[model samples]
Target chain A: MNDFKIIDDVMPDVPPPVVGAVAEARARVFRPHRPHRLRLRFPVWAGGVVAAAATVAVIGTAVAVPLLGDGAGDRTGDGATATATALVDSPGAEEVLDAVADRLARREEPERANWRVETELIERWPFAGDEFLVENRDREVHWAGPDGPAVVEVSRVGTEPLTAADRAAWEQAGSPRLCGSDSDCENDQVPYGRTRYIPADPGDYHLSSVRLSPQELRELPQDPVELKEEILSRWARALKDIENSDTPPGGDVPSDGDAVWWVGQRLLTEAPTTPQTRAAVLRMLSTLPDVRITDGVRDIEGRAGLALTRDTGGPYAERIVVDRATGDPLAVEGMPTVPVPQLKGLPTGSAAFSKLIRRMGWTDEAPALPEGCTPRTKKDCLR
Target chain B: MITAPDEVSSITAPERFGVVFDTHYEEIRRYIGRRLDLDIAEDLAAETFLIAFRRRDRFDPARGSVRPWLYGIATNLVGRHRRAELRRYRALAKTGPPPDDDGHDQRVVDRVAAGVTVGRLSGALARLPRGERDAVLLAAYGGLTYDEIAEALGVAYGTVASRLSRARARLRDWLGVEL
Candidate 1:
């Protein structure tokens, strides 16, 4: 049997009329699609007027004096509605963020021995029909110094069958022992009590991984525009490397706006930044024209702070809450704003998650295991 | 494979999308058609072009040609209909050829012979793993070279070779012929 020829002959020729139909469909549906750049380039001055009118209407207060520009024309009623719908078009929000940025620039980085960051990550997986198994992991990460290797320790702090039905289903599935000596059991069957420590290597640092070396941090431009450009070039080069390498494609290529947002996230959370770099990052964030700062204090982990947010036009919207007094980032939250079609059965916006910055800044004390953690290996207890 | 010259210049040009659609539409349609029914293939092929047109700015021609990239998108669409594909192959294996419309004595004989070969081939294909099957079919029917297949599947070049080798070996064993 000719395998190649048989597979080749599986389909008959596509009828010629289908081609005409597709062409007509493309012309009718797709031909008129315009790039977002055209819409984004509308005059900022016009945006400012509309923003002021909308603010006055929504807040039920007299319009505050325009910060940067004067109200241009009599375009007020429908124009206000349009500006209100477009959440990121607020120039007042930009002004608030710029003030926050100026505050960050004057701030100083406190001296410490190591950088310690604590995070709580919760994950839910669907189990037997209409049930979910949830796991919460608590992680503590320490970098010995700005340029030093990182030591990461993660412990699964809690696990519960998501619902009563889920609990019953778990019992039916043999109430599988967790964190046992047996390697044969399913991962979820094992109890969530183990702590694993990963020792870092010097070469593991990279901009793509969001961990910057001290040298790299020091070299960053203090000027906001130059810093943004440097971040763009660095991130673009990193993406190109991934494309050329055999590694699987990473996430979608970040747009300029996305890159700016990511740099802010990195500085606040992962990047080992000097005080100057951190201040510059905040200043750069303030200058981003599209960023929208929410008015009123936001409470993250019971700590009240100002919120800076940007909608990525994807499944999740990101917001960073900063200490109102210190201008230091207190928490970064990603709440799902839309349903992710790829992950089936989850309700829309149901799987909201956040990464709270429990601790940050240098400490004179060395990294150590948490109390009550029984070391499974010698490396896990290494100082 | 010859890499296309950097098409970053044409990315934002909406008119260039028609050029891409017209050039590769037929081949992409047939590629999906072999793995699925004609009607679904037609719809999917059109959807593929729409997605490509929308994401034109993200396409970097420096990586590979537009052809493999289009095939990659088509392949992902096919992946979603995997059960239907396997069912089609199994059905072909169980049933012999459909009765011929244009009946001639010699043509009838040829159809029967072709049907027998196809039935056995489908049976063998149904037994192959999904990744291996994808590599084999793209190589056989889509006429993609090994490098092109690597780009299409977003895998290492060596991985493509290994998967295709294993798949071909299994096919040979299943067919009881040295091929």
Candidate 2:
């Protein structure tokens, strides 16, 4: 027998394709295939009719916080303080969201072949008694055209003590090495590692591991109820591996509501969602059983917005802070609601993890690729 | 492998591609499944068939048979996910088999031996160049002949022979196993 026969003994045993999966695969070929018409231009807002329709719809009657800003110095802060942030449940979440959705619908969006999102991610991982905060700036450019793949470039910013107390503790511990191979501290947790480009299908963009085609996203249900069902179905398919595997990567499978919230956050922030679909997602989220809205909450950037927060059934409550007037997502925060054994030094109410959305919009300019790398480079080219 | 009359007719009758899919889908899926995660394998398998169906008019039976043609398409799709495949190998090299097996008496002993062989081989496979690794897997996991692999990878027959020879030598050096 050939020595190569040993490979068969090691390969992961795959279960036979299920009936639903087989049918889904079959439909891809049998269905009438038409390439989505590549949209080069955006619709210019025909002011009077669209504005009049939105005015008749309910404007936010709940609160008095101004939403519009000059967009200068708007993006800052990691919100790593040890203060306990309280989220008071309010009935005005739907009203506020509806008004914001109406504004987003009438908002003027630029037309560009590529979209880029620059984010500053700060994560605090507590090991033993000392806590380490790792920061990385990630830039992802999604080419909306059919030919080019999405590119993601990540730079390791730095790792340091999260607080002054933690810094003092670090000094007392002889300022132990936080980086390099010798140190036990692990900072490079973001899966994309250095810089990589993923060859997604035409008109598709990636969010974490899930791929969302722009045409399909734009074609999502406008009605909130129908939209929720659609999201749930797609999410179930994405979560299949986690459900089957005894030891999933991230521990237990998320609850249905948790899964919806997770996907909805990506749709709102990462994926290129239409105004109608964004509105639908917001409305749908407001109705989720565990999700609640906290009005007048300031993000790490010191920008005040409504925090659409959901109880994660853990120490941390996942929250997405969106700009009040424009409804653009400003930041995502994982605020600790209770003290846990793992994180002894961190306070209960402070955000242990936060991703500040510095810039997210369409641009004609493509991201600066690595040396000797172009938009069409299929493999990752290291600099 | 598909020697049936209806299967042979699919080369000419493009409409009969569904018959080809029905016959080869599981086999093509298993070939990719051995290289990558099952979820990704399922997706790439479907994509291979879709591409094949679309390019059926381009099918040149004079060059090769349909089985190798399908493998070619599937291998190309696997190439797109090269990073994920490499990551899988690295993880397996460190962790041995995924803790899927129930620790029974004799089975546990078999698993330990299997895990050791897998770990040693995975480390070597992960180090091989993508071309050599692809050739090795095509012969080992895909159970394709050297000619079939050459056709599948769009390489010369001699190239396949040299790559396999080098890969086998490297595996022997790393694994210290008898070929």
Candidate 3:
């Protein structure tokens, strides 16, 4: 916490001019800052101006925008925020809803008793990071209506298979490992290694249920094409399912790699047409809404980029920062980071090669997609 | 003549921010100086006011004084630069007394202030485990209520209460400050 009492008086105010350089970079990043740098939104102003020491304090900046600014100046309190504006009726509301309703209405089939979503494997591979890393693993969504419960099968695909050493480690790990000799192993069945229940209640909307297994983890492949295909196919399907869920739950990409999926979701079955949307917008303008930019700026494979942070509401928030110049995925990252209690989850740590947090980075080209891939279902991925 | 953050006209709102910092910048600076190294404290303090301006929008009219929120922001910003903080404390532990600006009656004022140092406060503060330290500092300096502190720190409120209780228990023992 800060001690604010005498700090303000001894320090002279920072002139808007002195804050220009770094402010310019911030404006570039956050974009369209008000009342200042009104020059066509994001002008990388050339050169710098040196203001007098008396005019601007020497606290000298560091790409910092003076703390997160206040909402006191917002006149937009009366209306919906820009994001909520889309959900405003805009006369298209009835038509859009009718069309969507008509499509679902055409199904005409009776609702089933048991709702089941299947999570099949799309692909997976190794993922490396600065201090934390893990393989990119994913289980596809299984969409079976009222079919008992969700189920999945796991198998190891490494060339050496589970070595005796691997099997021993598996036992110590309470045996999520498959084909281990340990009698307590939970990996004995197919199409149903585990059947975790996720209630259909709206309250359970944000939950991502999955049986994490070491048997599912595998070392990454050296071949770029094979690895890309495996990771991307899973990535696409997983993206689709998240968009369809009520709660924006995230999970490992239905493939393998050392990547962190930082997913932030805005949950809304009903769009901003309602008055609640306006109130929500007003609240948001004062304090940032649930939406968040991921791990922010970070270096990736030696280039500037951003990682993926998805809100698994629609077609998923899954995305990579393709370099503007090269259009390649410079890195991967995601959010909705839930800091787990100590000793509750896996060891609290990061091993560069073993740790897999995703980030956005520079690229020469768009990230390669699986062959015949379709964009994740477009249900407002920004949520 | 300053009204609450809510009373300021949205139009004049942005402008007054300039004035408020101009007026209070030094007091803020000194407070930070007492807490951290002068140079680093100045930066964090400066950044604090800057952030205060940006976050002016969030200032609740219901919540009159801006002091607590500003401290909260500064705490968060300081948190991002945690290594710098620990380094300042380690250095302060060695540097002995902080540099006094007035120099007039330095010993008397410094001694008295040091006596209240929150040193026991700071020591008890320092004694707290990391999680508890965050809750106590946010409450003591930032004046954040359980909910605000929890939201600011991104933890649950129950956690805030537990940590605060634990920290206060420790501070009470050390500073002997009556709860």
- TM-score of candidate 1 restricted to chain B? 0.85
The global Cα lDDT (0 to 1) of model 1 is 0.51
Task: Please say which candidate is ahead in TM-score: 1 or 3.
Answer: 1
lDDT of 3 by residue, B1-179 (tens): 12343233221223223334534555555445544555555555765664444334233322224554455555554544444555555554444334543442343454345453422333443456656655565554444566666544434558777777776676567655434
Estimate how well candidate 2 is docked, as a DockQ score: 0.09
Q: Cα lDDT for residue B65, model 2?
A: 67
Better of 2 and 3 by lDDT: 2
Estimate TM-scores for all models: 0.45, 0.48, 0.31
Error of 3 at A22 (Å): 18
Model 1, residue A343: distance off in Å is 9.6
Model 2: per-residue Cα lDDT over B116-161, one tens digit each: 3556667788899877887788777778887777767656678889
- Model 2 spans with C-alpha error above 4 angstroms: A1-94, A127-149, A180-212, A233-256, A371-380, B1-179
Candidate 3 deviant stretches above 4 angstroms: A1-383, B1-32, B49-67, B99-123, B138-161, B174-179
Clashing pairs in 2: A84-A349
Candidate 3 CAPRI assessment class: incorrect
lDDT of 1 by residue, A110-155 (tens): 7676776666543333332223343333444545455554556555
Candidate order by TM-score, decreasing, is 2, 1, 3
Interface RMSD of each: 17.1, 17.7, 17.5
* Every model's DockQ: 0.08, 0.09, 0.06
